[model samples]
Target: MPRFFSNKRLIILLVGVIILVALIGFSLRDRERVTLPEQLIKDAAGVGQEVFSKPAGFVSGMIGQADLLLDSYAENKRLKARLADYAAIRSEVAALRTENEELRKVIGKQESLRAYNPIQATVIGRNPDQWEDRLILDKGANAGIAENMAVMTADGLIGKVTLVTPLTATVELLTSAGTDYRVSALVQSGSGEIHGLIEGYDAERGELLLKRIPSEFDIQPGQQVISSGLGGIFPKGLVIGEITEVTTDEFALTKMAYVKPAAEFPMLDHVMIADRIAPEIEPVELRPESGEAAE
Candidate 1:
């Protein structure tokens, strides 16, 4: 026809009627495998599995809040290492209660030195140039402490053992000062026996005197003076003091009296050296005096 109406045959007859209406609309939407309604295909596959499980449930709730903040910072560092192990066991129980009260005052001074037969000693040193009446003991001569051993004091006589040393010793104090100290007293309840002497005049404020007595010895003034084993060095009754002054010298015939010792040699801490040796009793025989049995 005019060359099939020319313009290249009307563009190939409108591209073959748009490829026959796109092949009849792709054979009427051929992907129609539609046989739905199983509850609308399980509600469209649960809305596409709730959009891919809402990002895996928000990344599993942010990894469970980072494992509960790393288990609460490992239980706060295990309770600060158990509170520093309870403050180092309360300072070792206060240093074992001050070493058990110094071992109960050294077992109450060994039970008051077993009542006496004594020998135990210890007063290390003193006498840095005569410290108010000497002192220095630690027991000597294998504990038989010689050289005038008598030192006494559970509350009486204190001074003798002027120097020795197998282990150490030295004590000489009855107030020391050209010292002399003999005693053998009586008159607290009276039976008569007084004989006294003790001297010293100021070995740095430790003064003392207490001299001879015999002005018809009945010496009074709170009497009490003990220790009269007669120069066996001391041992007969122990105590030695309490008669504070009773002078008399209109032409001296003996009777001075001052005594006040009863152990206080600068508060002498610990003493006792007796070493036993007092036992000799014998005297009993009577009947004869009706004018001396008719002499």
Candidate 2:
């Protein structure tokens, strides 16, 4: 009997659940006015759904935004890397452009003095103990450079080669202290040429002294002076300088002029070595061996 009752209760419970489901479906049908309690339950469920959906949507949006921010940071880093490489390339291009311009100027200087063989050399060394006037060249005897060769810049003569080694050469500038070397020069007057001797430099005056002027009246302050090619050491027509001041000696015998040097000595750089031509050998006169001694 108890077992029968238990079966009957289970059947009743199943039936009750089916009836409750049916009632709920009928009440939820898209239709008319509902009871207050049913409306209250629906409202409560809607509120619960809204509260959960809002937080879920907010968390999804935050994750999406974080992904976008990471992409932007990566792009910025890539751009910065490219910019650094571009800056390095640009700096190298600018340096090469400047170097090309300097080389062009050196070529132009070389072409102007086309008559003489120009041995272009860089100034390798200078002695701080000596004045800034002295210079040492990178070319020497191995390069056919010898003593007494004239050293000139782009414009005019600057010095003469005094000492030479296998790999280097020393040049004594015209502005050196206690320098007694002289150069025979000519003053280019309008009518005729006047002779002068470049003797020494005047440090206080910052000009060179051209002493023993043949005619002081012929040489004005603006007259040009050039090498006369008298001693054959320096080339003819090489410009020395222009006269700035003229005066007579204390003994009243000769005139002196303060001439500005054409070449700037303090900042000597690329120089040209005027390679002098080989001296010509005199021809031997032919005569009989017995007749030459008797005559």
Candidate 3:
């Protein structure tokens, strides 16, 4: 080979240009085989990615676990509060049950004293001559009020419906001086209940006379008296009054107790008339049934 220049560097440069052209041609040619250097470089990059991804996945998993723990803590607090509230409600229910049981003992076997339907009425008139005996209400038969239905104030029983019209009804107070006026009453003595009749009123003392009590029974002052429900007119458990004095009849056959009325009859503005579920039935005459002759 002839030296192209008298320099060793020029000879090296001509050979380098030939090798560069050969490498460019080899790279551009269509080939499926990968070069060894390229394979090594790609494998190193893949290894680095795998090494870094493991730590990233571990960190992400730890973060997710921490979030779940925080959420569980919050939910536990809420559930504990609800449990406390449930305990409080249960205690209240137990107290109410105890109170109701005590009330049942005091009221006796009467399942409910308030079983009657109440009709609200306003006092529209009071007869001056019969101020302590009779008053008129604004509701009557058309309003489902009937004769002998018990009338009461917020405090206690006071009267009964004696007459009913379309738009008005007359109520006879317990303080009436009528000779025939009577009420079946029960005196709640320490011994037991003493059945009696409320036969008369003492206008002089402003008290009621609960008579016909058996002399054997011991009744004292300050004992309570209520309607006995033996009379078909009044419902059971109507509070009448408290006893103030006790005495025997003229014949000494029975006892009598003076009762201080619970209701203030003169201050009556609003009243409730009790319409009992059970009504008194009148006997019907069994006459000729459709042309049958009477005996």
Candidate number achieving the greatest TM-score relative to the actual structure: 3
Q: Which residue pairs in candidate 2 collide?
A: none
- How many clashes in each candidate? 0, 0, 0
**What C-alpha lDDT does candidate 1 achieve relative to the native structure?**
0.61
RMSD of each: 50.1, 43.8, 43.3
How much is 152 displaced in model 1, in angstroms?
A: 13
Query: Per-residue error at 68 for model 3, in Å?
Result: 62
For candidate 3, what is the lDDT?
0.78
User: How many angstroms is residue 217 displaced in model 2 relative to the true structure, after the best TM-score fit?
Assistant: 4.9
lDDT of 2 by residue, 146-262 (tens): 776778898778888876655567788888875546777888989788887788889987788888885445668999988876645666677888899889866778888999988
- TM-score of candidate 1 relative to the true fold: 0.25
**Poorly placed runs, candidate 3 (over 4 Å):** 1-114, 279-295
Write the residue-wise lDDT of candidate 3 on 139-211 in tens digits.
7667999777899998889988876655567788888886355778999877788899888789999999998
Question: What is the clash count of model 1?
Answer: 0
Mark the 10 consecutive residues where model 2 has the least summed lDDT: 278-287
Model 1 agreement with the true structure over 242-272: per-residue lDDT tens digits = 7766787446887776667777665454578
